[model samples]
Target: MDEIEVEAVDTLDPGVARDTAEYVLYGGKGGVGKTTMAAATALASANDGTATLVVSTDPAHSLSDTLEFDVPSRPARVREDAPLWAVEIDPDDALSQAGMFGQDGGFAGGLDSLLGGAAGDTAEDAAMMPGADEAAAMQLLLEYMDDERFDRVVVDTAPTGHTLRLLELPEVMDSMVGRLMQLRDRLGGMMEGLSGMFGGDDDATEEDQFGDLDAVKERVQRLRAVLTDPTRTDFRVVLVPEEMSVLEAQRLTDRLDEFGVPVGTVVVNRVMEPLADAVDVPDEAFVEPNPEGCEFCSRRWDVQQAALAEAQDLFREYDVKRVPLLADEVRGEQPLRVVAACLD
Candidate 1:
């Protein structure tokens, strides 16, 4: 693995400045500053005159608090003067709109009717199915991708597990749907042959049994194309300087590669600045002076330095950007701007 230097002006690095991808995804373990990085990127894009939308797909949304604005389910302006929009995807609402929870005209209803049953699977039960959240989240992302209002979309994705599920959903759903199509063809052919023997109508329309299957297949194909296309989409990994965070990020990067998504950048957030500049020390070690610093800060900084070196060695294949810890929590455009500057 080789490391490279990144050139930047203010908060915009060469990687971001030169990027033309339509979608940017930031994913990592929980509490790793994904939302902050995503928001800062979106804000920088808007400041650079690109129409951008920053969205949070995590169930526990922090976009609102991070931006210090009321973000609705639909895209709303985060600032009056800037060309930036923000929203938090509601999983239940997305599922309902996509017809995943429909009891009368959806998958559960059709299945129940085909089996001649009265009480079918409830919406709650359907929601509990494996990858349900991922499926809904994918639909929401597809909607934004199809929209032409924004030039770019920055996604603050869910934690590692859910994000991986979302990335793998397209292939899994495509295979399942392909099998269903084959079964439908076989059953339809058999039914028609039996009807001919009985002199019954062979052209009866039973398309309702395969409600929206074709559409679903097409959607999966489209999403797969965009996600796997390196020119259109890029995934960035964010982590703090810690053993758990570095290991998790490595695992996430490997999984993304399996899905054929590009992991172009790794952001090391909350890196500690050198304490030696702030605390003047004698040539020899002196432990009795409490005025200059405390033991806890020194110990924590030492640990952070070790973890930082480990992260650098582990992620040497990718472009790494270091962000120092801020004095104040990053909220609103001003604080986000500060972070963006540090990203360089």
Candidate 2:
């Protein structure tokens, strides 16, 4: 495969730049290049002099491989030349360290003693809920958003199913927290009576436990607000040039709309374009693939064209960008720069 030498442009075209949002999230079906797109965008933004952090919420992390940087569990600079940082969040670790259910079972044991173990079990069950890992990962994302070290945060979210569940987590967690708080309120007198009987200082401990719950509720509200605010966030759906990918992107878009999260960009990755048209070159500088001579190329191009048509119509109202299928894997800064230029 012949490689095209992509020249470095001093500035991204203003009209094509979508880096205005403080938080940009790329999400779609699995293996559709969301990580590549997110890495490219973060690199571009950082090159443009913005302090950018690229975060991977997907359990199957690929940011490290895509950027060719050893990304840590916590945010760290990926490139010395550019203001770029990256982190592949470990959700389980985060959850364990979050103190959500209290440290060393102190609060949990207290709750159990107060309510005959039912309250503790309920709290533990909530913490181990279906989307608990995602919730933990999202909490880390929220913290990064507020971090003063970076001006912009690009998120490579999990695939469609996990992404949708992550979006729903704020409301689900908020409701759960509210119920727990209410329960605490109703059991206040009972807890006090029991504490006096056992000669334990349960009042202060219970107050502290409920305080943590209040803090979590506040953060959930803030996350929801940031997601819905168009100026602050942009949820970009990435997909490949295939019928199934297109349909999945559409479904993701619909769900994002339902969540009131701003969706302004749709990135169609791996679109089969003419080799000559895919890269920057002078007229007749590169030989174009003769689809007529290659039946497989011709058939694949036809399929891509059909999918592109449907995607264009489905995402007509949004800013749709197409990334031509490249001859090489998009790894390291150079390839990421090429992908970013294509994005422009």
Off by over 4 Å in 1: 1-18, 100-129, 189-211, 274-292
lDDT of 2 by residue, 189-278 (tens): 554433332233445575555566678789989999999999899999999989999999999999899999999889988866533443
Every candidate's CA RMSD: 8.1, 5.7
TM-score of each: 0.80, 0.83
**Candidate 2 C-alpha error for residue 96, in Å:** 2.4
The lDDT of model 1 is: 0.71
Summarize candidate 1's per-residue lDDT along 210-281 as a digit string, tens digits. Answer: 545567788989998998888999899999978889999999999999888898899988765521221222
Q: Of the candidates shown, which would achieve the greatest lDDT relative to the real structure?
A: 2
lDDT of 1 at 342: 52
lDDT for 53 (candidate 1): 93
Error of 1 at 177 (Å): 0.6
Question: Superposing every Cα of model 2 onto the true structure, what RMSD results?
Answer: 5.7
Scanning candidate 1 in windows of ten residues, the lowest lDDT window is: 274-283
